[model samples]
Target chain A: MTHFEPISPLSVLDPRDRGGPVQPLLTIQGLKKYFHSAGNSWFGAQSVVRAVDDISFVIHKGETLGVVGESGCGKSTTARLLMHLIKPDQGEIIFDGEKVGIDIPLTEFRRQVQMVFQDSYASLNPRLTIEDTISFGPRIHGMYESKARLISHDLLARVGLDPSRFAGRYPHELSGGQRQRINIARALAFNPRLLILDEAVSALDKSVEAQVLNLLQDLKEDFGLTYLFISHDLNVVRYMVDRVMVMYLGSIAEIGDGETVFSTPVHPYTKALLASMPSMDPDQPTREAPLSGDPPNPINPPSGCRFHPRCIMAEAACSQKRPALETTRHKKSMAACLLQNRDTPIPFPPIKVSGQ
Target chain B: MTPNQALETQPVIARSPGYWHGVIKRFSRNHVAMGALIVILGLILMAVFAAYIAPADPIKGSMLRRLKPIGTPGFPLGADELGRDMLSRLIYGARLSLLMGLSPVPIAFVIGSLLGITAGYVGGLTNSLIMRTIDVFYAFPSVLLAVALSGALGAGLTNALISITLVFIPPITRVAESVTTQVRGLDYIDAARASGASSYTIIRVHILGNVLGPIFVYATGLVSVSMILASGLSFLGLGVRPPDPEWGLMLNTLRTAIYTQPLVAALPGAMIFLTSIAFNIVADGLRGAMDVKS
Candidate 1:
């Protein structure tokens, strides 16, 4: 196996850092959102769409929790739910030890929690000057000093853009990467405690993505911020996040430390996702085949386990009973699969870690 | 690091002033729009200085000089049925016509934009109610609605202008609502909301900034419609009454002299066409210049 060098996590100690203890920044419990979709008139009754059915996770202070899944797996929806952009039918979102109930004055919540969207190109207002765009939040939140110009300039410099040079420009003037940096600058202007990056760097090219990822890592350290990083690319997630949560069909299939989850995936879905990553070496022998079929429709999901129909190691019990996410023999990891209960200990082939 | 060193490390082309200048330069290159802008400016100047430009008294007439052909010595564009200098009347007519055209547009724009922004950004029940009300007005043809409103309000210049302005509000509101709704869905708006921006702040800063440009462009296009409607109302004696020197009223006064000097009677009609087309061209140019897709 190729010895991939492990990158050290960036650390910048803030005055507030106690070094002894820290609390979880955000905790979501039993979050569920079912979208009601009208059925065909010819059919008997209307059906319900379980967009984000029973998903839960906790993001600690100064850490990034990466959620990885394919499209329509409710990853984006979950992020939106956390941001409270869309109201969830059922869920408990606790922030800084306070349970966020319905109508819980979003202004304060918004200041604490900010989200960076996927499409950087369409994310900005075309008509607004770059300075106005960045200063917008500060002005709205009343964060500016008497000299707003000086403060705005400082913020622009912090984001690696000169206020004098770039402030007056509009969105159309900047490139994809530059626009994304501006987006980040805008989010950070308010000094948010938690940043929800919803595929933030997905639109950029590889080189730009790498630069942005580095900037994010630096920002995280500098601010001591917690992040809920959402993405479909497992490698990028592995590189950026401290822990990983694998979601499949609106539910978490697995959750563990990033290193452990990548090195030894407990869930079959997570294993398949890892296998599907295009290998860096083209000449290497082909790995396992990509996922067989499309995800089951959210309007009417399959019974028992949602992934059972497509899972390779599925058994009779997997098709009959819904598996709950529980700790495996290694208590540090969690997986929702009946196979973990089997006494046979199915002899699965060993996964080759790239940086062994 | 020193401030200069930090500046040196920054991207070379990231200067804000230079970038904005580039956008402005690109917008300026549109020739048809520039020409239209010049025409509108000239009309505005002419309207503002209408009294000084007219050669003879607009309301005072010469029965002997009635129906005189244009370019006949002292009188240019000849005289109307009342024998008032057509040139003088045309110049003075610009004041009322431009006022009637431009004034109602902004009124409609302000009312429409507020309703539209609220409807679009709020969504749900509010959106439905406002949109349905706008839909009711939209069902009527604009000219018919103006005529109906004028008829209801009874035939005065102010009443006609009011009716025309009301007639214009539905479309402007519809445009504003649609544009705002689209803008509200953008990630920046969501980002603004996520940054603890109040609903008002998000709508004003993010949504309004994006939506207003297109709405203003559309409203500018409506100025011509307003001019025509104003003229039509005046022609029917339901707008500015006779002897007011309004363009539409002038056209109506000159109608009887069609057989004798067709050119003289057609002068006011030609002016209306030119001014309306000028406003339309300017609107079109602005739409093209402001459109990001273009």
Candidate 2:
């Protein structure tokens, strides 16, 4: 058997050199994705679907950065862009001093980054055995030698499955939770620096989702891993992430520490998202105001602020110019709303901290 | 374990063996498909052992045996126009007919799959060029195209095979292209790309693995059509020449003996029908077996 020396130049560089103290492990600057639909007679005009429009975020080492939004807000597209699953039309992805881009080799990129997909049932190859699916990454990257069975068993055990019993089984034979665990195990087998969980537990039942979330927390602690967790479920994001970024219509509306954002959301859209969640305490009063209208068509988003049509606190400036994400009164927190501006003494919505 | 206990646990033990096992089990339940598979396999075996199975030399003839009726004591299926033993010649004819039928399918499949996969996966100019080329060939009817190609290539078994293979390439390419296109859109292929798998690796590992099963089943179905076409070419004297015991050529030679022994003339036609039917059955079975949705 021929063995090649591990020849990755990026691995030898010190991660701290890329950013200052408290610098992010992964920094995505100005990420954008525009999907052009083929022009046809039925649809008179050809348009670009601005899926992930100039979104930016930083993922600190050993912390989970949760990206939350309703569907079509480009949360999934952001994850894909960061992972380089599809090339971003314009952006720079810097991972640990290495300038990561579309041209980076997948085998080397796979060693540092991995993704756990949304649908556990479809994520795994139905044709492969459970062991084979789990071992695919390690085998492909040449991480394990000839003792594939032993490595597969170790991975299966790490994911809390009995390798002796379940290793030979196929994906359809396993339950949804089990398949998801196998998927996670497959990603972890490569010892990746960053793991992107793209609604990893969304498809599982409530109890199974909790279990998987717990498992994820444990795995992160054990491996000292960074995560880009994309989810629509606010409850799960609160439990799993250190910081939360709210996306609306392919742009970040607000970003801050999880507790700060949950307790006192600055953006109207963020507040609306939190307010919509069903409260557990019967004694607690609910916000009566409901967010009106569906998300704007991504093909032709509203002019100026994309959320102005849906936002309750829209002003004259909101309709004319886009609100850039600027820092507010809270240190290290930002909101993309004219209301957050010092010059604008705009009356804000009453701060409602229901469950806290 | 007791027999009852063992029986009870069988379903649990079986679980899901894998995707391929599921496909096989689904295929087995289709009776019409299974019968076709058996017939195809039987024809293949007959073709492979044609030399040992044939009772006499296919080309040799004697005046005494000429015009002998089928089911006669000495010559069970009687003799052809030249007095060649009908049973011996029919058995020998299996070799040429099956070869002519089966050989062109793989050639067409390889050419078509490459073209189709490229066109479907890589959109824009490359796709447009390959698809338009395929359309040009598809514009002509398959039989007419094959006949023209054979005439251009000049008459021979190999030339006829080449012509028929060309005739089938467009349809096979279309099937392969569509399947590959669908497979390319799957999430796993994107996952593979994210993992830093090269374009070649993505195509070979992720795309081809998913698409091949459907393409293979389609190719198997085309085998029967290729065989019949090959036989037709032979009957027209553009394929296997005289003295070579081919089913189509046998029909042509025995056409004159129809008045004297109608049953003997029917023998070659019966062989062609049985062989073609067997192939079609097997192809149907494979289609049922490989269908993931079923």
Top model number, TM-score:
1
Model 1 lDDT tens row, A163-243: 667776778888898889888877776667788999999989999999999999888766667889999888899999898
Cα-based TM-score, every candidate? 0.88, 0.86
Backbone-clash count (model 2): 4
Off by over 4 Å in 2: A1-21, A39-45, A101-107, A147-149, A279-289, A341-356, B1-35, B55-57, B60-69, B72-75, B78-84, B120-124, B253-263, B291-294
DockQ of each: 0.42, 0.25
Residue B157 lDDT in candidate 2: 94
Please give, for every candidate in the order listed, the TM-score of chain B alone compared with the true chain B: 0.92, 0.89
Top model number, DockQ: 1
| Lowest lDDT 10-residue stretch of candidate 1 chain A | A1-10
User: Tens-digit lDDT track for model 2 on A137-187?
Assistant: 666666564555566667777778876667778777789999999988878
Q: Over 4 Å off in model 1, which ranges?
A: A1-23, A36-47, A101-106, A127-131, A145-159, A162-164, A283-289, A344-356, B1-15, B18-28, B291-294
lDDT of each: 0.81, 0.81
lDDT by residue for model 2 (B111-202), tens = 99899998988867888799999999988988889889999999999999999999988998899889888777766666666656678867
